[model samples]
Target: MPVQQLRSGDHAFVSYADDDAGREVVTTFTWTGLARHEKVMVFSSPRTDESEVWNSLDAPGPLLGAARERGQLVVSSMRALIHPAPHFTPERQWQRIEEETGRALEEGYRGLRTYIDMHWVADLDADIAVMMHRESHAQHLFTDRPYTEICAYDSRSFAPDVLTAMHRAHPCRLLSRLGELHVEQTPGTVYLAGEADVATREQFLSAVREGLLRTADERRLTLDMSQLIFLSAACAVDLLRLAAASEDHGIRALCHPTGVRILRMAGAENMPNLLLSEVTR
Candidate 1:
């Protein structure tokens, strides 16, 4: 089947039983759809079967040639065949995957189109959800391009928890030091990852309220509490209030496992948007 007509910044996932077929899809999507048309951004997964795949595309001369010619970007992955139910509990495995995915996104695509192609089929829903969330939420994934394109291939079912954790660990540069703020924009959403006290929380709330008031457009907002080591009842209230204030804007808050217990003690049922992890590797 031909690759789908994806939006300019949409992620395009190409999955096939044959390596040649997968390579062809990537080539067509980058060369014909993006390069030739100059109207779309493409991204594949980090797991592909072909190592010399880029060199095989003669029409584009080189993968970079097509990109330079059309003023777009093409991204692919190293050869990795992962099992659908394979265990990923190892700490190093997760770190390796994150590192590889991060490097691919940063160096392969030079600000044009973004492409990602996973070589194996794990959890379809989780992979796609993670891809969408990361490409849309994390800022450092694309150095110059501010758009997102995430595609996932699946030959099986979906695991919500696994997907959520994957999204949490979707390889973005961590903002070090407490109280530092980072504004991130992704497809269909924006997130603010930082640390803060009561005062900073209030400021964030104000910014969020203004964002909601100023745009009337629905957006998903995530407050990453992965770094927050301490909490107070007042801070919990501030978070809940933030969620309540931005309810109309589709804003949601996320915290780590410890944050969950703290919020619960503070009388908050932080569900749906609270991304919890089974194992922190």
Candidate 2:
């Protein structure tokens, strides 16, 4: 999922292949948090210098600088967070996080969000089991309060099995970066935005299929393509094929004029289960 969609109480796990990709996520995450009036904290990787993090967040603007001046944005490390404690313990970490959340609220911010790099796992010489336990059991921190966190894991730093386990540990997972396409699903609808061409065909099909399965018992399922900037003919045909396959449920596609035309050219009119409705701009 795009980082922008993350809300309070969401704990997201994100993996990055390189520093560039990682920076893109954190930069966006930080700006989004600041924009939402949430206190933003970044726990730099054990090997990363704090200065590098500062540089990455510094854009060609004054917003970041002003946020820093107000103490709303902090760049720190895990070692500093659990200070006075000899070592890492789930209890200590959780206690500190709870205290921080309360402090952020007391400071008049809506909530607090942190981007923690999982390299802290090895930095603290902490047990992997204990770390996983912390990740899975940290829901209390977000139960009703407004707190969001992202545990970033560098792909090169952890083994495949460990990475997979950590991915499952978190409730939400973030996409590496915002690519050419994005897809999100709700109860009975699938929302498609961005360009949907051969490059994004598989993603487009997968989201539609999942939406169909989720809304199978309902009378109608909606494919919300009004936000879609471009739709390829191949993807249009894929939608028609899926609709044809699922004849029991009606698929209502809400699209712009161009999208409707693309589907019509792809034989959408012939599919009895598919209804194309043009959305006005």
Candidate 1 lDDT over residue span 1-281, tens digit each: 12333333333333244555555555655564444334333333434323354464444455366454543443333223123334333233234444544443465442334344543234233344544454345444333433434343331233555444544544322222234444444544345545445646665555555545544555545444444444456767766666565555454445556666777776566444333332121
Q: Runs in model 1 with CA error above 4 Å? A: 1-179, 185-188, 210-215, 219-232, 246-249, 270-281
Which residue pairs collide in model 2, if any?
none
User: Tell me, what's the RMSD of every candidate?
Assistant: 17.6, 6.4
- List TM-scores for all candidates, in order: 0.30, 0.73
For residues 1-281, could you state the per-residue lDDT of candidate 2 as single tens digits? Answer: 56766889999999998998899889989999999999999998979888778888886545578899988999988888999897999999999999999999999999999999989989999998898899889989889989999999999988999899989988887777655577889998898876788889999999999998898788689999976768998899889888888999899999989999999999988989898999964
Worst 10 residues of 2 by lDDT: 56-65
- Give the candidate number with the greatest TM-score: 2
Q: What is the C-alpha lDDT of each candidate?
A: 0.44, 0.88
